[model samples]
Target: MEKTDVEILFEQIDNITETVQQYSNETYLDSLAVTLEVIFYQHPPEGMDEKLQEQLQNFIPQLDVSKYKTTEIRKALQLAMLKGMKGATQQQHLMTPETVALFVGYLAGKVTAGKKNLRMFDPASGTGNLVMAVLDQLETAGSVFASEVDPTLINLAVLNANLQKKEIEYFHQDSLRPFLLDPVDLVISDLPVGYYPDDIRANDFELKADEGHSYSHHLFIEQSMKYTTPGGYLIFVIPEFLFDSDQSDKLHAYLQENAHIVGVLQLPETAFKSEKNRKSILILQKKGPNTTAFNQPLLVQVPSFKETKAMDDILAQMNAWFAENMNS
Candidate 1:
């Protein structure tokens, strides 16, 4: 008997779970675990065949399904497929569906009261997943512009945009370099980490202690502020080390003095495969002279997932919090 699409998906999930379980240390397993969880949580694709199902099932015995939420498992599987399709090496760090969903929900909350036709920008849009997520939540009048340093990633992002039927203006360039600054209502970026492609250059003035000197994140934050409108928001996924490091102190201080630090979401180590334990999302809004003050940072520390219910509960909590603090 032929298996159903849902059955194939389930088998795929099982295979991925097995793969994750095979590794003694949780960190050694592929980051696909998060992708699999996201897939199950969101829309499950249809029409998978038995052959594909069997191939996916091959990896099930390696994962520890008990350690992840259902949504996370689905996301992990989806991410693994995406990586496979892209021919990415084992070292590549692909964004999971859960990350995208979380970002989308945050963007949705950030612009709830803004103009109907918002302008959005992503400085380092890899595969366009983050931009697509933002586009999904914006109004029909919203427009998106994105830049990817890698030509291959640009091609993939273009394909993704086409698949989603989203209207986006994409550029192949290093976003960190100086360029024609366009005014925007929102800027959402996931800055690169560790080693980047050869074409990317560090700013001349910004110096790194271990790495070579480049323009600091302070420069990036300043540049972002320059292009954003007074009431616009800037959401960034930064390395956790930078978030609280001394180098980041000035940026945080600047944000506190000039902008409103709306929220800070500390992601799990599993959020990005490359950095291990240092990654977080900083949500900032450019404040005008009249901007009101909030009591404390809307900080959320998401726990490691081991079940679908946990993921759903986390999402619900985040959504409720956003709704409650819409103005902040």
Candidate 2:
């Protein structure tokens, strides 16, 4: 069978990374600049919000599009970007894996049925892949909002959004800070993983009251939970250590007191095959002040990619679990 558009796009994107890497004199920065130029022309800034268009207009340089077709340009844009965001510059900068991306869509699709025009947020949206995943899974349209701690990575996020012709206004700052932002329906992110230094401002959150303690993934979880609407769902890709780690005892208590741990999915080992870190996706639905945990959360394992029956089986279990527990 002929290659699908997605397959072709992936191949072309790989070509962009290889080609850019091979350029003896070209910096990845220069290659990145070229990629951004291509993205803007391929997905014109017209019809975008005036402020967004104005912000985008300031940066989109005219490029030599005569060399490659529009499809190739978009792929090249993706390729260069994938290469640019290499590793954990911070937890916010970790590259989301393709398998996890697929699972994110699956997880979202399971619960979002019959809902239309939702609003979503990813606090530490590394290149906004989770944001992309949620939008892709939704049957109807929705708005995406995300914040990235890294300025450079946020540029990549903007470029990717332009390529997809999606509107996303990214806040470039620390997500841990208690900024007065609107509570969104769906809150999601692959939050920063390891310990945070005292100067990072994560300790500023009221939950991190212990001046002697160093904040880490636990802080991200707490802050994101607060950011989500009381009835909204907060999804995170967190370390397996979070399940019973001494470090997160306070976090666990807070979670027990305030939120409903909706779904715990053991991600496949390949979810972060590069770094080989054991991680899981934690789906929590925030609760109102007087609310008590009414439903027992579901804990399921992600099936292997080769397991033909895995995804369907996993989702089926979740569907039954949600039917019993979602609003109970």
Encode model 1's per-residue lDDT on 1-328: one tens digit a residue: 9964434555665455444434323332232333243233332223534454454455445434455443443343445446444545522245534564556445554555556777888877766777766665565437778887766567556654543456889878766666575788888876665443332354332232234443345556666776788877888877677655555665556677778887777776665545564567778878976666556767887665555677778778876766677745
* Candidate 1: segments with Cα more than 4 A from true spot: 1-81, 84-93, 96-101, 194-212, 215-218, 270-278, 305-320
TM-score of 1: 0.64
Q: Number of clashes in every candidate structure? A: 49, 1
Models 1 onward score TM values of 0.64, 0.78
lDDT of 2 by residue, 1-328 (tens): 9975555555544444344445424555444544454445644334534554443344334333445543444444554556655633434545667567667776666555556787778888866666775666576547778888776677777777776666777888777776557877777777677666665475466456465555567788777777777767778888777767656667877888778877788887765654447788888878876445654677888877667687778777777877776543
For candidate 2, the lDDT comes to: 0.66
lDDT values of the candidates? 0.59, 0.66
Q: What ranges in model 2 sit over 4 Å off?
A: 1-30, 42-80, 85-92, 198-200, 209-213, 274-276, 289-294
